[model samples]
Target: MFPQSTQSPPTSLQVHPVPFLANTQDADELGAGSVEVPSWQIPDLVVECPKRPGARIHKGTSLILPEAGGDLLACIVRSLPVLLQIRPRWILGYSMAVDGVSLRTMYRQLEHSGPCVMIVEDSSNCIFGAFLSEGLRPVSQCYGTHECFVFRTPRLAGAWRTEVYGRSVAPTSPSQIEGASVPKPESEGASPPAGFSGQKAKYFEALRKAQAPSSSASVFCNHMGIVVGTDGPALFIDQDLLRGASWPSVGFGSPSLCTAGTDFVVRNIEARQNRFGIGAPNANERPVK
Candidate 1:
C-alpha cells in the first residue's frame, strides 16, 4: 500500500519545483481551501527487503534503476496517475542502483557521452515528468530522440466534484466504511475456541452439507486472479492466480515480457462459466479456452 503524509521528503532523492499543490485532492477542488485527494493519509506498508536491507522501498520514495532495462520505466510511469490523484507536495527521484539492472548503463551513457539534443516536441499533450533539459534548460529546443522522456504529470483541476453535492438528507446504513480495512474484534477471543481433543461424554456429531457457489460466477472484493495468458491470437495463461486484481481491472495495456508476470483483472468476471473462454488459475476454476 502506498503511504501518504506531508511529513517530509525522502533524503536520498531530490524533488524539485516544490509543487504548488498541497494535500491529496482530485484535480478539482484540490487547491480550493484544501483539496480532497484519494486515500493517501495512510502510508504504504514498509517493505522489508531482506536481500537489500539498506534499500527502504517506502511510498513516495524515488527508485533509480541501474539502466532502462525491462519494464522499470513503465512501472514507474504508472505511478504518475497515482501522484496526480494523491497530489502530494513533492516526489523524490532516485538514481538507478548499479549491478541491479541494465538500465543503469543507459543512464551513464546518456549522462556523459554524446551529442544528444531536443529535435521535436509533442506539446499538445502536457504529460507529467515530461521535461527536456540541457544544462538544466527545459525548453522546446532542448529535447531529442531517446534523449529525454515526458515525465511531468499532467496537471488537472476541478475534476472530482460531483453533480450531486449536498450531504444526503436521509440517514444511510453504516454498512461501508470508506477507509477502514482493519477489522475489530467482536468480543474477547471472539474466534473459534482453541482445542485439539475433547473430554469424554461430549457427544461429537457434526453434519454439514457441501455445495458449489450459488452461481456459475462469483465476484469477490479484492479477489485474486492469475494471467491465464495474453489476449492475442496466441494467448498464454498462468497457473498462479493474480494477487493484485486492481492493477489489471482498469485495463490491460501493452503487456511487457519481464521479470514480473503481466497481470490483468476482469471485473465482476470469473474463471468459471467458461463460455467467455477465460481460464482459471487453479483446480477451483476452469481451464483457458
Candidate 2:
C-alpha cells in the first residue's frame, strides 16, 4: 500500500515558466550564426478544469485546449490508474507545443526538488510521457541508471499503456539542477563547469552536439520524451505509482530498468508558483488569491 502523508498536500504549487520566447542576445553570444529570434510572444499556456467551468487550473499555467475536449479527456481519465500510482501534489507547467529548450528550462527551474510528469507527442501525434521520479539531472549524476514510469495512449488506441524506464539516476542534491532555466547562460557557448565532467559532461556534450532536439542524450529523454511534440506539450507531477509492489530495484541504477503493475486514481491539480518575466503574465495576474 502507498504510505499516507501525515501532512495535507499544499494548496498552492509553483508552475515553472515555459521558455518558448527566443533569446537572440544569448544566441549571438554563443555565435549562433543567423538564428532568427522571434520578436513576438506566444500565448501563455494554461491548464483548466472542465468539471469546474472557467476555473483556472493554476494561475500562470499554460493554455488549455478547448478543442482537445473528448478523446484527450478520455485518455486522461483512463490514465487515472496510472496517475494514482504517483500522487503529484502540485501542477508545474503544461504546454501544447514544447521544444527541448523549453523542457530544459523548466527542469533548471525545478532544481531537482521533486518528481514530475511530462506528456509528449510525436510527428504522428502519438501521446506519451514518463513519471520522472528524481526530477531532471545529468546522466553522470545518475546512479547506475535512473528509473521512471512511462505511459502511452496511441492516437488510435482507447486505453493507455503503462511501462517503466530505468535509464536515469536520482539527484544527489537540490543544487545539482542545471541552470538551463535561463536561456542566456546556457546558450553562452561555454563548456560544462568544473567538477561536472566524465560520463555526465560527455552525455551533456552529446546533447549540445545534437543541437537540442525534443529528446536529447540526457535521462530527460526517458522521462521527457524521444519523440518531439507536434503541439506544445503538457507537464506536471503525479503520485508515486509503486505502492503495494516492492520498489522494482534498489540503488539508483542497480537493476537498471524494472517494471511494476499498472493501476490508477483521481488527480488533483494545485497552484504552485507563477514565473515572472517578459512572456509571463503581468504582475497583477500573479499570486492568485
Candidate 3:
C-alpha cells in the first residue's frame, strides 16, 4: 500500500510524497544547474490488482493505465504550466504513506512552490486526480492556498476541471450548514482575498471558513481526518462542469502502464518527460517551458 501525505493543500486531498530517490551513479551530476534541485523520479514498484477491480479502492491494490493512455500521463505532466517553476512529486493512491526523511527532502526542495499530484482509480475504472499546486506540509499547519485542480479522463470533455467550489448565492453565517457543501464565510462579512475574483473568490472564501481555527467543524483542524459535509482534503472535480470540447482523453490507472509484459505487473511508476518517447528519462532536460 502507498502512503498518504501527513500534510495537505487547502481544501484538497492529502497526497503521497515521492521523495527524490538518488542513484549513486548520478550523485555527481546532481550538483548541476542554478537551483541544484534534485529531479523527482518515480522508482519502479510491483503492483497487485484484484481479479475484479473496484472503484476508489486502493487497499493492497495497484492501478494499471489503459493502453490508449501511453501518452496520457505525459500529456498530463506537460499540461501543468507551473512545472516550469517548481518540480513535481507524484503520490500514487491516497492511502499510501511517505517516510519522514523523504517528506523532509521534498520540503527542502519544494519549500514554497511545486505540486504533489494524487493518483487513484474509481469503481467505474476511470482515473481521478488532485493536483495541489502549493504542495504538501505537516497536517498540523493551515495548508497554504494555491491553485488546486482536479481532473478525470475518457470523459466527454477534453478540458480538465480547474475550479469547482462557489459561494452561496445568499448571505449566510459562517456557522450555518447548507446541505453537504462546505459552509460560506460571507455570513461573517469577510472579504475575499486580493486578486481572487468570480468563482475563485467564492471557492477560497468557503475554504477559509471551513479551515478557520475558530470553526469547530473545520475540515483541516484535525490532522489527516475527514469531516462530514466537507470533502476530505480533496480538490473536487465536477465531471459535468469540467467537460469541454478541448478536453483531453487522459485518466488515472491504465492497464498498459500497469503491466510490463504478459507475466509481470508494474511495481512502481516511472516519471517521464516525453510520454511518446522510448528509452531512459532525460535526466538533464526540463521538458516544458
RMSD of each: 24.3, 20.5, 18.1
List runs of model 3 lying over 4 Å from the truth: 1-75, 85-114, 154-223, 226-289
lDDT of 2 by residue, 185-288 (tens): 23466643333324433533343334322222133233422211110111212212111111121111211111212111212211122222244333233221
Estimate the overall C-alpha local distance difference test score of candidate 1.
Answer: 0.19
Worst 10 residues of 1 by lDDT: 200-209
Lowest summed-lDDT stretch of 10 residues in model 2? 227-236
Cα lDDT of candidate 2 equals: 0.29
TM-score of 2: 0.31
Q: Evaluate residue 262 in candidate 3 and report its C-alpha lDDT on the 0 to 100 scale.
A: 11
Q: What is the number of backbone collisions in each predicted candidate, taken in the order shown?
A: 39, 37, 29
- Residue-wise lDDT of candidate 1 within 1-289, one digit each (tens)? 2334578734321121222222254532323242222233212212122222344333442222211121222222222333222222211111222112222322332332222111111122111122121212112221222222222222122232111001112112222210111112234233211221131001110100010111101111111111111111011111221111111110111112111222222111111010111232222221111
Q: Which stretches of candidate 1 lie over 4 Å from their true place?
A: 1-41, 45-48, 56-99, 102-289
Scored against the true structure, residue 172 in model 2 reaches a CA lDDT of 43
Candidate 2 wrongly placed segments (more than 4 Å): 1-90, 94-103, 143-147, 158-289
Write one digit per residue (lDDT tens) for candidate 3, span 193-264. 222234643643455444533222222213222111122222222212121111110111111110111111
Q: What is the Cα-based TM-score of model 3?
A: 0.33
Model 2, clash count?
37
